[model samples]
Target: MLLVDHVTKIFDPGSISEKVALKNVDLFLNEGDFVTVIGGNGAGKSSLLNAIAGKFFINDGRILIDDIEITNMPEFKRAQWIGRVFQDPMMGTAGNMTIEENLSIAIRRGKNRTLNWGINRNEKSVFEKHLSELELGLEERMKTKVGLLSGGQRQALTLLMATIKKPRLLLLDEHTAALDPSTGKKVMEVTKKLIADGGLTVLMVTHNMKDALEFGNRTIMMQEGAIIADIPLEEKKTMKIENLIQLFEKKSHTPFANDRMLLN
Candidate 1:
């Protein structure tokens, strides 16, 4: 459903501090494919997602979503085609908006605004059903302001908002990183259920090696802005933490070098 072709992004081009964030990176995700991305610092994981989301234009190369070229599209325009959940829980929703209000916005994605009624009975029932699956009691508190929620609760709500429209592609940028381990695991569980239930395509960036292995149909390891290894689910299931480290070292020839990642 998504394709990136030989994309490259260089920051501060021709300047002394020029840093190559992405170097001819290419990847493709078929419909319903859930791919987990892993890499150390400076691996261009975020840059790659940003490039596809059209946060900014790449210096060269093309980004296509279902055969529609969007390499140069603006971020707001791309919002209709892609859904993103960020590492920071605070980013994906309006803190002051009530739960129902926030969901009302997501439900209207990719559509022109109308003078229609908002948050009526039908929509409320749909939101309630979706929230009930999170098992977080959010369905009972639909009138509460989102800012009143805990990080995990807010993130759970954001996950729902992002997928309400069954976006063509889902981008998760270390979305569960800020939560405690148990909470993060729960969030990942919810993520898996949603993906399967909708047959959605997803690309999730994560620092935890185990999550990278356990959660997706494919695992991709990046280094210096390019994919060094792409392991299919069958091969990935047989991979231990040690095996992954070895493969990363062999491919990047420098060992996956994040202290936090190793300690985790």
Candidate 2:
């Protein structure tokens, strides 16, 4: 469902501060494939996703989603096929809007909007039903303003909003990094449930090694803007943490330096 070929991005080209964020990067994902990405700092993990999402134009190569070439497409035009969650919990939703109002916006993503009767009863019921599945009791507070919500609550809503329409590809950009362990785990559970229920394709970038191995069907480790290792489901099922650490060291020729990834 997704294909990236020899994609390259260089920042400040020809300058003393030039940085090659992505170098001949290539990756492919089949329909319903859930892949977790892991790497040390400066590994270009997020850059890969940004390139696919067309946040900025790449220097070379092509990107295709569901067989359509979108390498040159702008970010806004790609919104219908991609759902992205940033590291910041506050980035996804309108804080000042009520929970129901926020969901109404999400439901209408990529569709024309009008000021017709705001949030009908049927829509409210559907949103309530979906929120109840998170098991967070958000159903009781649909009328409450999102700004008044806790970080986890707002994040849960963000996840729901991102996937309400079953986006062709979902991007999770270290979304749980800002939350406490318990809350992060809850959000992950919601994420897994939602994806499984809809059979959505997902590419999630995470610095946490344990979460990276535990959640996705496949895992890809990158370093210096290149994919050093890509492990499939059968191999991943029996893969050990120690082995993974050693693999990264061998491939990158340097010890992993991310404490949150190594210690967690």
Which ranges of candidate 2 are over 4 A from the true structure?
115-117
Give the Cα RMSD of candidate 2: 1.1
- Show the lowest summed lDDT stretch of 10 residues, model 2: 255-264
Residues 1-264, candidate 1, lDDT per residue (tens digit)?
A: 788999999999999999999999889999989999999988999999999998878998899999999998899899998999999999999999999999999998777768564779999999999999999999999999999998889998999999989999999999999999889988988888888888899999999998888888999999998899999999998989889899989998885567756435
Please give each candidate's TM-score.
0.97, 0.97
What is the Cα-based lDDT of residue 67 in candidate 1?
96
